[model samples]
Target: MANRFLSDLDPTTAWAKAAVDGKLFTCGELVRHAAECHLRDIRHGERRDRATPQRTSDNMQWIVNAVRSRTNCAGKILIEGASFSSSRNWVSNGQAAAFDRLYGPAGNIAFSPHSYYDADASGTDASCVAGAQNRLDPPLSWAAVGDREIFIGEQAGSGLDAVCQFVLPAAYAKLRDHPNCIGWTRWGGARRRGSTYAYRLDPSNYQTGEDTPQMKLLLRFLAQNP
Candidate 1:
């Protein structure tokens, strides 16, 4: 998928020629792609194994190199080091140094970590764990120590309770106030028809155009920050 995406952005490729004719993305625009390197534990016929942190770091390095080599794209890659299975501290455990080596004086790459306030640190639940707002503190500190940029590429809470009202806002504010943190992308929007996902951001009706409680909370934060 990365190869295909990069090829499409290569100006010399046929796909790029066709896209340019159709007025697609220009080479000057800052293109960003997220590589969600989630640690996976696979089970096959009673055999169970999980991806090693070293392997994850190597894969992410490959993506960073690939993106950097595409000089024509003028892009950046958001490399994820944390997910449901692996907590935010995964970046500090040797992966940060590995990424620093790959980045190597370049400014186009940043660490992209997912944050959730649930009991398992997975966004699947609506209720937040205790003191969930401070969950990203360690990872943020690690990023600062490495002088690395961070982008929260995916984050969301399911309910309009404390998870959305308190925890989500506080966590987002941390990202906003942190100098090393660049930005964040909220998850749970743009669902397909009839989908029952908990974090869907659609309004009740197109005419009413009422923001969901979660959206309202996020928008309020944006207003204050802006």
Candidate 2:
């Protein structure tokens, strides 16, 4: 409607006249145009991420910093903040630093450096081993975060022992024994690989009323670490 209306007038002068010529415009047209622009601005604001990046990052930083300090967790607590989530538009450096100070003081907060293992990249296990020793431990690039309680949070396998066996024992120990490492986290919840939803490890699903082999492993680690 706006394009059609503007097309009938002198292209050059019509726009300029719209700014000053009350004679060429009606009150209804002016109100409707204002409403259009107002709606446009409103929609533009809505298109932004669920929250502003800085705001989300700020919240993330707070959550990261509080990992060690959360009183709700009564035992030795370790957190695995994934290396700067690109999809989430958060940088790794900032996230890494949030725990840097914490590690020095309390040694409870730590981040999981991405090896791209679960990301289906080539030779991820090798990458995980290297990161565990190099960056995930003390004297990493951010030297402030030295020898702290580091956790490798992954429930190995692609939801099956067969899948996890390929990476277990072989690559698992290197990650567990890496310098400064304290424990592990199994991402054994719900995961998708190819067309199948990887096995769900809700514990209750087991007929023996016991943990699956994977749960047994994680539980053993917790028992030993705590």
Candidate 3:
């Protein structure tokens, strides 16, 4: 059986349906019971910092393997991290084994360790680089899959110049050697709603809108290097 791509109608509901249809489960009763047990454990954990019993059937790996064994899902299985989605942190403990057991060794799938940046406090390039490096440390396999040292976030008019010229390239220089470190993309191509931050990297104020000076610099670098 090939791997399946399963997401939620709602995750809990989807899990129940998948379990029943796959025949690993005979009825929704067991599935709902398992979910209730899991939620109770989660709620208990929030109230007291004590250990919670693990749900045997609803663990992501169990679902992944069951669906993979039964369905024709061939795409990469994007999993929510253990912190939010599962009782156990499978990736931290045994990522390779967990993924292999579920999806097999075809190497068609990749894992995305969700990482983000908050520029509200305003950080320097060095600080941003350090932060990204820290995030990349544990999820090293993402580098093999396709990770980059670029920050993709919202920026204002002048901010784009700052990011492209100094911030991004500096970070890229730090981590560009890794093959999976592809590149960065901005969160929004243009400013939505209303913002003082010029959406156009090169607006009328500048000669070229999208092809700003920073972009030229980037293109030149790519052409020269590549």
Question: How many residue pairs collide in each prediction?
Answer: 0, 7, 4
Greater lDDT among 2 and 3 belongs to 2
lDDT of 1 by residue, 1-226 (tens): 2334235433334444444344455433212222122212211211232344455556667655655665545566677652232334445555555555555325577777777777777676777765676767876787888888888777777656754577777888888889999988888656452235656677746688977766777778889889
lDDT by residue (1-226, candidate 2, tens digit) is 2433234244433443453345455645433443343333323432543223343344445554454344454345434332222211113435445444333224344544332234332222322222222223222333223545445544344324443444444345656556655555555443222223343344544465655555564555557655
lDDT for predicted candidate 1 compared with the true structure: 0.61
lDDT of 3 by residue, 29-128 (tens): 4355445545444445434521221332125455556446656766554443333322123245444344433333323433433332223212222122
lDDT of each: 0.61, 0.40, 0.39
Residue pairs whose backbone atoms clash in candidate 3 = 3-73, 4-73, 147-181, 202-209
Those runs of model 1 whose alpha carbons end farther than 4 Å from true positions after fitting are 1-50, 82-101, 193-196
lDDT accuracy of residue 50 in candidate 2: 23
Mark the 10 consecutive residues where model 3 has the least summed lDDT: 148-157
**lDDT of model 2 at residue 160?**
42
